[model samples]
Target: MTKLRIGIVGCGSITKYRHAPEYAHNDAVEIVAFCDPNVERATLMAEEYGGKVYADYLEMFHNEELDAVSVCTPNLYHAPISIAAARAGFHVLCEKPMAASEADALRMIAAAKDSGVILMVGHNQRLMPAHQKAKEVLLVGDLGKVLTFRTAFGHPGPESWSADGKESWFFQKDIAIVGAMGDLGVHKADLIRWLLDDEVVEISAFVETLHKEDTEVDDNAICIMRMGKGSIGTLTASWTYYKGEDNSTLLYCENGVIKIGTDPVDQVIVERTDGTIDKYDVGAMSTNTGQTHSGVIDSFIYSILTNTPPAITGEDGMKSLKVILAALESAASKTLVSIH
Candidate 1:
């Protein structure tokens, strides 16, 4: 069994906790190198993960005989790094929102297409076993026609992860792109789309900064979406939560309501027409999410070896990104925006 030689771009906290560790743990992956503008961080991660480090990812691409790389950089750097890696004949697993803009996202996709290498996105939410099962249930009509869905994803803020303590790129529009929407809301958009098996057709939103001072991006955002299949959905993301929680999704169907998350209540519930109720703790599924990234990395390696589309392709990421982008536009215009 040959291991896929992998490189990692950007040695940030996400890279440290998720991407690098996931790749390192995978039997089919050998992390060959790492890149970051901050050489010390990159070097530390590289040494810890058994890889060499470089300040420039392009140099790593040029020098290493790698089969793939994870672009775990800031939103602004996603395109260039993925494009370069793909052009250098390395499959790319880019961290999400795809890119800062649609044009850059498309370019990265095109590069991977031209290179004939796998272009996977780290929309890790869809990998949750409970979320995956929810998708299966919805697809099999266990929910009996989706009527409506609601989801929310947020954290306190990115200050804990950012190098700049309180003054972080998360607060700056130029570097961060958008705050809660891009950072956390995008995951909700992706999960909702995956579970509902539908594309968002229209959107209306409100985005605002409620707490953070001297920041250009919204700390809170709410978006209403009309899916192509006539299912309406609502997404809320914020950094204002007094307590920290992970993502969760809810759906109201003709048959029952499905709920998911770390909340102390039922994880999923089913109510039959005869008034009988079926409840699943879904606690184990939360444990499953712990291995989601590892599953993703193994799946990526499997896809490359088998010559199959990744579990989450660049197109999948793009569709999810479009929803978030549409939400942003709708929030800015204060109107329902068509998601064409």
Candidate 2:
């Protein structure tokens, strides 16, 4: 079997903790190149992954015969980098939020289509055992007729993850565009869209700089959404959680209410009309094993080997990006925004 040669474009925490290590374990992938403006970071990653290092991504694409590449760069670079990779005749697995703007997202999509390369997005949450189980339960009607979705995600900030801590690009509007909404809300939005199997048709939102003493972007945001099927929902994202990660969702339906999140205590809780609450440790069914990278990487490898579309595609990324961007627009304008 010919292993797909992969070139990774960023040497950040995500690349270190997620993509690179996952590809290392996958039998179907051979990471052949790594690039980062910081030579030390690039060199370190290359040494660990047994890949050549390059300071410029363009140079990596020119030198390596890659089958695919992961765009793990910042929001602004995502479109241009992925487009360049697609034109280089390599498939793409870009990090989430797609791009800084809708126009950029569309341009990347066009480039991928023009290049005839598979463009998958790194919405890793979709591959989680808990999320996958929730999707299954909802899709299979186990939750009965879905009525509403209330989701929230908050975790202090990415200071611990970035090289520069609070001084990281995440705190700069020029570099990150927006704060919590861009950094974290995108994932929650994508998950809600996927689990509901519905498009967000309209949105009203507000974003404020409730924290992060030095940043110009909002540290928190709250959004209200109306899905295509008339289901109403609420989404909350913040960089204000004192400690620990919290990404959870609750769905109210005709027959029961389902709750899901990253809780060692409980994953899925279903409340029935009989006044009996059933609890399911959905994480126990995990192929996850507290290892999201492995599961996502395995899925990517399977998709490529089977010549099948990824569970999260560029199109899927764009749809979710639209909602996030629209929320930003709505927050700025202080009005409801149409998502069409």
Candidate 3:
């Protein structure tokens, strides 16, 4: 098959360090264009990635013969660009949290459906080997009836990962919409839902800017979630993890407890009530500085090439976004928010 002509619409740290380089390494993909309001950044990326630079993504979308595009821009621009790309006949690999709001995310999904294009979200946590193995184990009923779960994703701050560091769009409310909740929390929301195969029905949360100074968005969030029928969990996303990155999920089941990403050498561990411990080495989770193939870029390309719906479809993204939006509403209103 011919290489999938690709374009990326953001020159930020994620696009620069993660997305662009991965696409460059994929023999099945060809980087054809780069777009960012920051022309210098786009130009510099184009120089390295072999693409045309554009300050306006709309212009690039219309001009390039792209089979697909990655909407890696600031959170606010996600919906508009993804929608436009769908309408322009390009499959979309939009960076999560799908959009700034539920309405926008829904609109993006509708636009993709109407345009007959595949739309995928960049919730890569689901692609992690440990998480995948955990889901497989859960499906086989090895852990009888998941009772509850507690998951967390926290780091020093986006300043360390943002292309602009402290001044990155991640710290700006207008650009990022919500802070750690949107950035780190959405990943967990997508994760727990995928692992348990249950949607979050309600959420109560505390979203705050506890540590970061002069930030318009929250630096931390702790969410209590009601999943499907009866199972409950707590999701914590924080930018104040000064010690190191902590990304782990603990699922309490009737038969045993399953720990994922909680151990250094052992990535997935199952401790049964029968007094037996099972361990599986599924490799390490990808970090900002880690040099692992995110599987996301490859998966997106495979979906387009194989003419199959992406694993993380637009609707899946919408559901995850709904959870985050509901959590944000709950935090703002100081009440439990229901997801409809």
Candidate 4:
């Protein structure tokens, strides 16, 4: 079997903990090149993963023979690197918050379309075992129509998780675009949209730099959204949850409620109106502290090998990004923003 050749851009914490190790474990993939401005980081990854290190992604693209590339760079670089890879005829699996702006994301989609290569976004929340089970229950109509929902993703900031610690690009407005919203909020947005199988049509938000000092980007955000299917909800993303990580979602339905990630043993809990309850130990979610195989790499490889559309396509990413962008606008103007 001819293995799929992989090239990884950006040797940051995400690449180190998630992308590199996941790729290494896949028998179908051979990581051929690694690129990062910090040549030392790239070299270190190359030494572990058996790849040639390059300081520039463009140089790596020019030199290596790769079947796919993972765009694991800061939020700002997602567009350029993914676009370049697509144009070079390589499938791209880019990290979330797909690009700094919706326009750039559209261009990336166009590039992949023209190049006839797969372009997938790394929204691993949809692939979480709990989330998958929740979706399954919802699809069965056992919970009735979803009425209202609340989803939150909070952590004790990225300093401890990022490769650069306090100096990570996550705190830079220029690079990260938005702090908590981009880092954590976007994931929830994507997940909710998928879980409900609905789009957020309207949104009002309060996005502010509340806790972290010296960061231009927001540290917290709260968005009130109305889904196209008439379900209303609140999405909160925060970096000041000093207690521990909170990645949970609650869906209120016509017949009952479904809670996800609330219990340690039972990841998904379903409660019906008649006082019946069901618990599922679907498996653990991948957290910053307890990392697990995200299943994103496996799905991406499956799509390529089987010649199928990615589980999360670029269009799916753009729709989710629109929600975050709308939230930002709503924050600045202090008004509700509607997604078209």
Poorly placed runs, candidate 2 (over 4 Å): 284-291
Q: What is the TM-score of each candidate against the true structure?
A: 0.94, 0.95, 0.98, 0.99
Instruction: Mark the regions of model 3 whose C-alpha exceeds 4 Å error after superposition.
Output: none
Alpha carbon lDDT of each predicted model? 0.82, 0.84, 0.91, 0.95
The per-residue C-alpha lDDT of model 1 at residue 165 equals 62
Per-residue lDDT over 1-340 for candidate 4, one digit per residue giving the tens place of the 0 to 100 score:
9999999999999999999999999999999999999999999999999989999899889889899999999999999999999999999999999999989999999999999999999999999999999999999997789999999999999999999999999998998998899899999999999999999999999999988999899999999999998999999999999999999999999999999999999999999999999999999989999999999999999999999999999999999999999999999999999998
Task: Report the Cα lDDT for candidate 4.
Answer: 0.95
> Candidates sorted by lDDT, descending order?
4, 3, 2, 1
**Could you tell me the lDDT of residue 76 within candidate 2?**
85
lDDT of 1 by residue, 1-340 (tens): 8888989998876787778888788888788898888899988987888888899887898889999999888788889889999999999999887898888889989999999999999887787666776776677786598899889887677776565567776688887788889888888888888887789999999989999888888999988889999999889998887476557788889988777774456565666666777666644433212333446777888899899999998988988888888888887888889987
| Clash pairs detected, candidate 3 | none
Worst 10 residues of 2 by lDDT: 285-294
Judging by TM-score, tell me the better candidate of 1 and 3. 3
Compose the digit string of candidate 3's lDDT tens values, residues 1-340. 6889999998888898779989988899999999999999999998888889999888999899999999998899999999999999999999999898878988999999999999999999999898998998888897798899999999999888888999888989988899998999999999999998888998999999998988889999999999887899999999999888999999999999999999988899999999999999989988765756788999998898889999899899989988988888998899999898
Against the true structure, candidate 1 reaches a TM-score of 0.94
Better of 1 and 2 by lDDT: 2
The count of backbone overlaps in candidate 1 is 0
Please count the clashing residue pairs in each candidate, in the order shown: 0, 0, 0, 0
* Candidate 1, position 255, lDDT: 85
Tell me the tens digit of each residue's lDDT in model 2 across 64-93: 999999998888899999999999999898
